[model samples]
Each structure stands twice: as structure tokens, then as C-alpha cells.
Target: MTTENRAGGAPAPAGAAASSAFRQPKAVWAVAFACVISFMGIGLVDPILPSLAGKLQASPSQVELLFTSYLVVTAVAMLVTGWVSSRIGAKHTLIAGLVLIVVFSATAGMSGGIGQIIGFRAGWGLGNALFIATSLAVIVGSASGGFAGAIVLYETALGVGIACGPLLGGLLGNVSWRGPFFGVSVLMLIALVATMILVEPTPRPEHRSSISEPIKALRHRNLSLTSVTGLLYNWGFFTILGYAPFLMDLSPLRLGAVFCGWGVLVAIFAIFGAPWLKARFGTARTLYGNMALMAVVSLVIGVFPDNRTAVIVATITSGIFIGNNNTLVTTAVMSIAPVPRPVASATYGFVRFIGGGLAPYAAGKLVEHYNAHVPFIIGAVTVAAAGVVLSTVHRALDAADQEQAHAGHSAQRADAEATA
Candidate 1:
């Protein structure tokens, strides 16, 4: 319920807090389990990109549209997730997302051509928008640990799901690319049941958010800056994620193994490395350094596209930095924004996802028109630009972090005095 900070805007060492931070009620774990599956959707199709291209008779650019269609729809629909959840309640919204994913994923598997599968993926994206928008709010509201702990739990699931997605896709793609789709359907169905049985229904908020509210939240300066930074970072992030698979020339299984290793690093860094680094370096410094490092990594991948081993190592290496960015940026968004959490989340999601959706599609075009290296070169430049953007907001970001620590410290003191 309360927290204290040491020097330089860091929370007091989490030693005393760590034990209880991870302990959660069964309901929390159930939602977390579902979250793992939900996030797996991000990378679930990665290992099958080549297979899909071959079987569907689609070009690399067409295959890349799979990412484009899904993420574009998801980004556009993010604006309404808060509005929809406020009316329907979180449980039903989550179930609706699950149902859509199941139906669309299965339909994608059965589709006759690339066009049909791409269309079906759009529908799946809408489901993802609803689920992802609400899942964080639900977990934060229900979890036993403090806000930091809940974030850790959520990021942990993200790391695991992302790590496992390629592995599952690889294994299933070995049988048939269709296998991954059916597998997600079955896994999500189980997650759906667990959510229904274990997670309690969330009551609607007192003042329901309007569709316009998330858009309005962007009027705040800090929120906009953070969102723009996210957009640029995402451009680089997805460039590698969306385009690199084609260059590997490995089997689906081998590709999965590489990303799986990447995912494991993502998990480890998000949980342990991020907090530790932020505590020592602070958010602004850490982000600047990390983004710069990512730029170099992306360039390495681009410069040596034909070097299988370098590309592979860089791919896995990028995960550590990506994991750090995911946690820190999410925290920064929550802290810096003055609007309600749901609205802030929706707004932030809307802005950043545009870059995420566009980058992969553009990467495909770049490869078609130019060389394989152009996308990564462009990705590196944009990522470096994001670090500069974040630097411009350094003062406000530091103030927000300090205020959060002060507020938490005051609460802890109040509790101590009352008990005494």
C-alpha cells in the first residue's frame, strides 16, 4: 500500500517488498495465465511467415501485410476499448476478445488464400485491442501486490508469451502452418475457461469513459511526448520483428529456437534487470542509453543481413533491451499522464501502435524496392530519434517520478504513525 524511495528517485530496495510482491490470489494468477496467451499472439505467426508465403502463394510483402493488417486494425480500434469496456464490463470484454481470436484464428487456418487470411487477421486484431486495453486495468485493480508488482507480473506474462509464441509456432508449423492457428484456438479456449471460473467480474467504473476521452487525453503534453517516443521506438522494434525472419533462412523450428532464447532474456530483463537498472540509472538516462544501444543492434542486423550468426545473435540480444524499454515506458506513461488510467492507456496505445502497424509494412516495401538493408538502416535512425525525443521531456519525467515516490513515502509514514 505504501512505498519509500532512496536517493535519485528510486524506490527503496524491494527486498522487503519482493516476497509479498510476487504472491497473488488465485484470481490474479488466472488472469495472468490468460495474459500469457493473449500476448503470444504478437509473435505466434512469426515462425510460420515463410510457410505462409509458400503455401498461400504470396510474396514477402504480402506475407508482411499479415502484421500490417492486424496491427493497423488494433491501433485504430484501441480508441474505443475504454469506451466499450466501461459499458460492457471487463469480464465480458475479455471474453469477447477471446471469442474473436478463436474464431478468426481458426478461419485464418481454413482460408483459401492470403487475402482471406489477412482479412480474418483484421478481425482478430479488433479482439486483441479490446483484451489488451482492459487486461492491465483488471490486473492492477485485482492484484494483491502494489502497482509496481502488478506491472512486473504483467510484463512477466508478456515476456513468457512472446518467448513461447515462436517456439509453439515453430513446432506446430513443422506439422503445418495451420497447426499454430488451431493450437492458439485450443490454448485460448482453455484460458477463456480459466478466466471465467477464476477471475471475478469487474464492476463498471463510476464515470464511464467516452470514446473521445482517450483522444482528449492526448492533449496533455507529457502524454503526447511519451506516445511519440513510443511510436519511433516501435518502428525500429517491429522492423526487426516483422522483417528479420525472412533473412534467417532457417527452418521454422530453428527460427523458433532463436526467438525463444530472445524471449527468455526478455523475461529475465523485464522482471529483474529493468527495475535494477532504473533504480541505479533513473528512467531518462536508462532510456537514452538503451535506445542508443538498440539503434546499434538494429544496424548490426541490417549491415550483416546475410550473416546468419550475427543476425541471430542480434535478434536475441535485442530482446534484453526491448524488455527494459517495455517496462520503463509503461511505467513512465502511467506516472506522467494526468488522465484516468484507462483513458491514458487507450490514448497511448492508439499513438504508439500506428508506428508498430506501419513499420513492418514499410519494411516489406523497402525490401522490395531497395535492398534488404534499408529497412534496418531506417529503423535505426528512427530509434535514435526517439531517444532524442525522450530527452526533451526529461524535466517533467523526473518530476513525476519524484512526486510518485514522495506520495508513497508519505503514505507509509501515515500508516506507521497510526499504528504506533
Candidate 2:
């Protein structure tokens, strides 16, 4: 990919000036649609968490292993995605990922015990790691609306998937906890078929990426700092995502509705709110403020874990902060990292997902040993610390913004010359 494409620079010549983010080639839409289903896996189990615990005769910690197995495996598997995708190409990798998800999700649905489901989820995570990393790069490379637009499109898919996952889970889980699993299996099968048909085959990279490249890329100060901050932020993000349903004490359907509301806000802010905030406040200020606000929200959850209304309101409100952070942080990683976009994505995913994977299980354990308040309190501290870590990179953020502006201006000049 060109530097402009990788860094969210200028739009490609095909539709440089006229391309709206919403106007994309059929292939871009195909990957994006797959992204929606892939992301649904993150929250598809939320409404069913309580149900799973009871049905499987498992403790909260044992049930939380579903997330632990999936995410932790995903995090580790991120290391090899670039290696795998480079050799076989993006399209095959995506198909491989989708197939794993379909098979494992179906098996998970048939599982009679929590341990069996957790094992299957780990397999699902491996596929997720491959699909998630490659999809972002494919979208960025093929999208019409420039790098910024591509990121927005991707985040929109993420937000939509997250929002719909719980709603679908609740709607289906109302009948049986296994319904959501089968639902994912069926939806992904369709996505796999669509991908095979719509997305053009990608050529293998001239040079294969080594597994160590992502870890080596982390030696760069800006990328590592940004990734570490992400790790801290996710610790708080998943704590609520994983553990808060128990506190809500609502039925599966109602719990899904609550998270669906949260996911809606996540989508809205990521698409619309993030751009406005970044333009007005600048990326650093926007991220700092956003992270601090999320910290406050986590603290609120900590304070009133038992107050259903307070927990619900605070949980939903955190989505706004989460959405803004997701867009801005991802943009920052793409722009500031010195390595290739794929490498940066892999490194960032490797580090951040570890936190996301672990936080929920930790929260569950903390609740078992201490009280509900303790985990959220810890979550608040970590989020606040993320803001502090981010402050160290103000210069990097400014430089990235300036570089993107320069590229945008240059692209406009080129477009004018071509027209003339």
C-alpha cells in the first residue's frame, strides 16, 4: 500500500475529491459487512452470561472463561496474523478465520459443559485474530474515501456489530442460550460466502513478515506508549462489558436491551462524535479528556454496583467515551507508528487485547474474593493511568496530525492538476 493509504492520507485517484466515505466499492462493503459479524462475537454472549453460568453449572469465574479463552487466544494469535496473511494473502486468511468461527461456534452451541464451550471459544479467538487484523488492512487499502474515511467505515461496522450482537443474543437467547452461538455460526457462513464472491483475491506480499516483527515494532516509543494506553483503557472497558450484567439483575432480554443502548451510543460517537471532537480539540486533547471521562464513568460504576439504575446509566454512558477513544486512538496508531500499518495493527492488537481478555476474569475473581466495587475501582484507576501514559506522546500526536494535513493538501493539488 502507498504511504498515503496506510497513514490515512489522501484519497486514491479513483474518486479522490468526490468520494464520500459512504460511497465505496462493492469489495469494501463486503469486508465491512464481514467485520460487522466478526465483531459481534465480542458481545454476543453478554446477555447469556448469567444463563450460561446457571445452565452449565459453573461459577461466575468459570463462565467468564468464555471471554478469557476467546480474547486471550486472540491476543496471542495476533502475533502470527501478518505472517499468515503475507504468505497466503488476505482473502484466504479471512476465509480461514470465518470457517473456524462457524465450526467452533456451532460446536460451542452443542457443548454440554462450560469447559467445552471455553475450549471452543479459544479456537474461535484464533480465527478472530486473523480476520480482525487483515480486515482493517484490506479495508484501508481498498477503500475509496481516504484513510480517515476507511477508519470511520471500519469503526461503524464495529459499533453496529457490537450494538446488534446483544440485541440478537437477547432475542435468540430468550429461547435458549445456545441460540446466539448458532446465530453467529449461520451469519458467519453467509459472510464467508459473500467474502469469497465479493472481495477480490489479494496477492502475497513480496516480503513475508516474521512473527517477531510486531514485538520488535513495539520498541518504538510512540507505538508502544499508544498500545500500553490502549491496554489500560481496555481493562476498564471489558470489566463493564464482562461483569456488569450480573449486577443489573435483569432478564436476558432486558440485559441485551441495556447493552444494545450502550452499543448504539458507541456507534454514534465513533462515527460522528469522534471526528468532530478530533477536529475541534485535537487528537491528544480529545483522547486525554475522553479517557478521563471514561475513568469517571468506571468510578461511578464502582460506587453503585448494586444500584441497578446507576449501574445501567453509567454503563451506557461510558459508550460515548469508548467510541471516541476507539476512533481517535486507532487513528493515532495508524498515523504515529513508524512500522507498516499491518505491523502496527498487529502490535497494538497483541498488547491491547491481552488487557481486554484478562480484565473480565479478573473482575469476576475480584468480585468473588472482595466485592463488586473493587473491580470497577481498579478499572477506574487503570483508565485514568491510560490518560497519563498518553500525555507523554503529545509531540507524536501533533506530528501525525500535521503529516496527515500535508498529505491531504498535496492530494488536493494533484487532483486539481489532473482536472486541469
lDDT of each: 0.82, 0.88
- The TM-score measured for candidate 1 stands at 0.93
lDDT of 1 at 111: 83
Model 1 lDDT per residue over 1-420, tens place: 223321223343443333444788888888888889878888888888988898888888899888888988998889999889989899988889888888898888888898998999899899889888888877766665555676778898899999999999899988988888888888888988988998788787666778898788888888889999999999999999998899899889988888899889888888888878777788889899899999999999889999989998998999989999998888788766767667777888888888988998899899999999999999999999999999988986677556544444322121222211
lDDT of 2 by residue, 70-171 (tens): 999999999999999999999999999999999999999999889999999999999999999999989878886667778889999999999999999999
TM-score (all chains, Cα) for each model: 0.93, 0.94
List residue ranges in candidate 1 displaced over 4 A.
Answer: 1-19, 408-420
**Which ten-residue region of model 1 has the weakest summed lDDT?**
411-420
Each prediction's total of clashing residue pairs, residues at least 3 apart in sequence or on different chains, is 0, 0
